[model samples]
Target: MNKRLLKLAVTSALTVAFAVPAFANPFSDVPAKHWAYDAVNKLAQAGVVTGYEDGTFKGDKTVSRYEMASIVAAAMQKDLNSDQKETVDQLSKEFATELNSMGIKVEAIDKKVDNMVKISGDARVRYGASDSYDNTDFRARVSFDGKINDNLKFNARLTSDNMNYDDEFATKTGIKLDTANVSFDALGLTNTVGRQDLVLGNGFLHDSAMTGIASEIGNLKLFAGHLKDSNEVYGAEYGMKLGAADITADYVKYDTATNDVDVYGANVGIKLTNSVTALGEFYNVDQGNTDANAAAYGLKFNKLGLTALYRDVEDGANSAYSGMHNDIQTLKDEDGYKGLEVRYDRALAKNTTLNLKYQDFEKQDGTEIDGGARTQAAINVKF
Candidate 1:
């Protein structure tokens, strides 16, 4: 076909595919009286076409396969009806080779859609009993993640926990915002600010949510935040890999009214075999006049989905924000505790899991506290 005929054919196809009114003309060469003016204007507004750098449509000139492929690729990114999508799909196949040579895949273009926000959540039913107490509860969490741009993201979670089955549905529990934060990259560091989750040194020293800012680069992270108790905390953690072992070191300081408390921790995991790993961690806390320490050693049987650990924590060693406070509730005491814990985890199906845990603890003085032995079973599901 001649150049004019070919250009007319292309313009007609785009006009039929995107039948929208044009607000303004972007190409100087296409006057309002021109035959293809509306079609060219609509294509420009939809990002389906960009004329030459000189700002002229030059519709009399023939369009190359590469140029047509670029237009098809851009159309694939738009929200279209069934008929429009089918038209674009046919065009994509016709120009697949040109699109691929230009570093764009027709299949990838077809999959492109506006998926800026995602919603996910998990629910759990748990039962636990100890020497002094037994209870059953349910917990649910919903999370929202939004991509604002290539460099910025926002995340939030709503959670309700410890809902008694016997209570009225509406009165069982109240939902609360557990986390809200935005993360971005700047100045060679990835930074997160707001209420966010934080874990340090294999969770031996701290594991909880904090309100403030955290920055990370490479294998090092720096954070300054406050716990639920309103005490400000500052910390840094560095991790490195050496041969078959991974090591992490961290330091945290709590800024309180009475005094500044410091904590130091080191954690290591060594691969012992294909299905077994050895883990160790040590933590020391300094509270001015008093000093305390905690240590743990464990073995992880990866293939069997089991873990066994022994932990010793002095009366003042454990952090109030430790995640263990929730997992091993019987061990929470001002007098400190030492314990042996065993856990078995297995996936029953996709996005579903079963967990069984048992712990035995005694006070530092070798006396058993009430509810010192505890066991729990939980089923968790995620979507």
Candidate 2:
């Protein structure tokens, strides 16, 4: 088979591999007698998956973030209907704005041909200095978000690095997830479901639990969803909150998908006057004899054009969906986080001013796993 066809096949198989509920198909170009025959064969026959030069398909091989985006781009381009065309246009504009945060200019995008939907992707060549290593990592991602309704939406995000001299190639080269969700405000309630994000304790608690979150009352909300425990465990979160007090629990799935990692947590929040506030997060994971305990807290003060935050994390939940440390747990083990952030805005002139930010992160353990800190400042001009 042509090499291009082979690449296309790999991409197609990727779609199945990343499916939230992965479906393994059984089939192969080789005869059934081969023990490892299935899925790829079917995908190949359907022109979706491909085999290797050695006539062997590494079905378990993980696809990385960049490879996934290229594949998605390829797959989406196959259908050039008018509906899909409109979607691409709108998506491009949205992604352009998102990439702006990383200093990428809208005009610099070099979208590949046969592109569908609004092709938006970003590349960041970041250099960092840490005790572990003074290194550089490149992150490139392409994504598309299509509106399903005024209150509903669909989003797919894919990202990966340029090179992998790190981790010994133990991880996949790319990452991707398809999210179909609904979010709206009505009847005095803001309800959101499908794939989503979660935040608690001003980020002393951040959970991309993805299950769901609803703002049912004033300055108060309720959430229930699935989260991952440990490095490779799925858990569910059941939580309730009122004002400054919140309590939550997780049911980890022992036998299956929805819930395998469990956590119980609580937080108390208080706003001091109009410019000062404080919050804290405490979480405990149930892993039988290996229960884990964690906590995090933060303080925020803003008044007269100044804002500051002091945040820290103990053993917390771990949700790797977003590079964010949603729970107190860092994605990497032997991790602990502590940081301080202060941002100030001074209106030097009417409709123009400067914004400044400073942040620092030091892990209890000497690994990048503790999650680094960010400090940045910028000037803004209003039209």
Q: Write the per-residue lDDT of candidate 2 for residues 1-383, one digit (tens) a residue.
A: 35434433543453334332322422223444433234323322323222343323444444433333222232232322243344433433444544444333343353332133344555433233323333333455666765555555455656563433334433655564533356667778666666555554333435344544444445446555554442332333455555544455433333234335455556655644434456566666555555655565565443334555554544433323323432122335534555565666543332234455555655645344433655333333332
Q: Candidate 1's C-alpha lDDT? A: 0.73
Residue 327 of model 2, lDDT score: 18
What is the C-alpha lDDT profile of model 1 across 1-383, one tens digit per residue? 25434433543454333323221322234445544445444444323344544223555455556656655665565545344566677777877888778655565553453345678899887767675765566789999988787788899999996685446756757899989999999999999999999998767678888999999999999999888889999999999888878899999999998899999999998878646779999989999988999999999875466899998999888678676777624345656888898989754433455688888878889998786688877777776
Show the lowest summed lDDT stretch of 10 residues, model 2. Answer: 68-77
Per-residue error at 323 for model 1, in Å? 1.4
Regions more than 4 Å wrong, model 2: 1-125, 140-143, 148-152, 160-260, 303-331, 335-383
Per-candidate TM-scores read 0.70, 0.40
RMSD of 1: 20.9
Query: For candidate 1, which ten residues in a row score worst on lDDT?
Result: 18-27
